[model samples]
Target: MNEKTNRIGILPIGKVPEIVPQSIAAHISGCLDLPAIILPSLKNIAGCYNENRFQYDVGKTLQTLESIKFKDIDKIIGVSTVDLYIPIFAYVFGEAKQGGKAAVVSLYRLEKDTHGKKQPSSIVLERAAKVMLHELGHLYNLFHCADEHCLMHFSGGLQDLDASPLYFCRYCSKYFLDARSKS
Candidate 1:
């Protein structure tokens, strides 16, 4: 948890919403007390909605990581929507391995809140916080938790995301702390 030494890199896969990724990254870095580095603007990175097919290309993502020279990074986090057609988790793993990191975190919004009405609800921000922290927890080698209210709980829908708490459960906290100890 040494804020000065721990560097978290936020990479935009393609053209994503201007707010979501930055918001998520800031929230995560604040929670973990780590230095968050947002990468420079990218060109070839395509957005999920911008592509003809909904699929994400794992190989393409790996190529992007390679192009960026992954070795200089400590950890790279990718934010994308589930609708992007590609197996985002697979791409995450591919990139993580290519970068010589233990893991990478991927995030998707559970609710459809484009206009800031209806969908996301008031707790949308909290839900986003949960997703970022949950995925970051994975980077620390933490596993899913049985506690439905814990941030580590498996979320399948907006309700699931809403049901989960923003903070880790006691057991999960121990694992998170342990991971940081090693870091």
Candidate 2:
């Protein structure tokens, strides 16, 4: 697939680790050979906050991503350091509208100190990129890989995420290439 024109835009929702945006973009570019960029931060997260749960509602955040004004961005990813949740699930690493333009990842659970312990920056970045790739895979209509080692594999938590590599499996890679080539 020709990747020169494929651009993935990342939106940071709130205060994030300085390394996150560029780390993810570089990882995505190198792993998928696609042009990925750090887009402007998506502040104003208050509108999406749920007072009762004290977590950001991902559904509302996706609405925000859909309404964002960008210049020919191929895919939109919203990254946040805050805890994120949907109504049904207690927590999610990220969520994407199946085959949709927008996806969101929360660095909250990706952080080792999520319950209150500090984590090394390197591990943090790795986990964040893993989750982003997983969600972005969904944006491209790539389903959860049956292969446990693939990036497209569904991750229930940090351990599950850490077990997968930062790239897609070969079978999934073919699907990714075909989908991206057609797009």
Candidate 3:
């Protein structure tokens, strides 16, 4: 495999809106400066749902995405409409294994208000892009940054996620560039 080609695949799992993945692909190229393509839509998320929490398990989602072999693709970012949760947290906008091949971002909560009301598409798209970039940073082995302005900063809620910038900080940008070069 040619590691030099760091192409990213944006996959929609379950009933994700078409615009969501399209916007994510655009963000990948425009902000991250990497080539991104949208993959075919997947219909089932069978084992991801937790009957108790009523939320999808993020670990299981990543595992499902990793199980698929995307030829010539260096990394994949699965976008889902379902709410995602890790056992440790109430919910997570996204999840990725450090330096791993696959990551996922959920648009479920991003489009909704604190009261569960829907927000405008523009706001939702912005939130999803932020989450995708943050998760992608983890895929590159970048850790959470203390700098609030960085895209790698951990967002505890929608407000925090909203406050985060779409680009990485200087320190993280250096690390990202270093990691990309080694790829």
* Index of the highest-lDDT prediction: 3
Q: Rank the candidates by lDDT, best first.
A: 3, 2, 1
Which wins on lDDT, candidate 1 or candidate 3?
3
Ranking by TM-score: 3, 2, 1
lDDT (CA) per prediction: 0.58, 0.85, 0.90
Per-residue lDDT of model 2, residues 5-57, tens digit only: 46888788778766799998998888888888888786668888899999989
Winner on TM-score between 2 and 3 is: 3
lDDT tens digits by residue: candidate 3, 1-183: 234369999999988888999999999989878889999887877799999999999898889999998877889999988889999999998999999999999887888888889999999999999999998999999999999999999998998988889999999999998987777
In model 1, pairs of residues that clash are: 14-45, 54-84, 54-85, 55-85, 55-86, 56-86
Q: Which candidate tops TM-score?
A: 3
| Candidate with the larger lDDT of 2 and 3 | 3
In angstroms, the error of model 2 at 49 is 0.7
Measured against the true structure, the TM-scores of the candidates, in listed sequence, are: 0.69, 0.93, 0.95
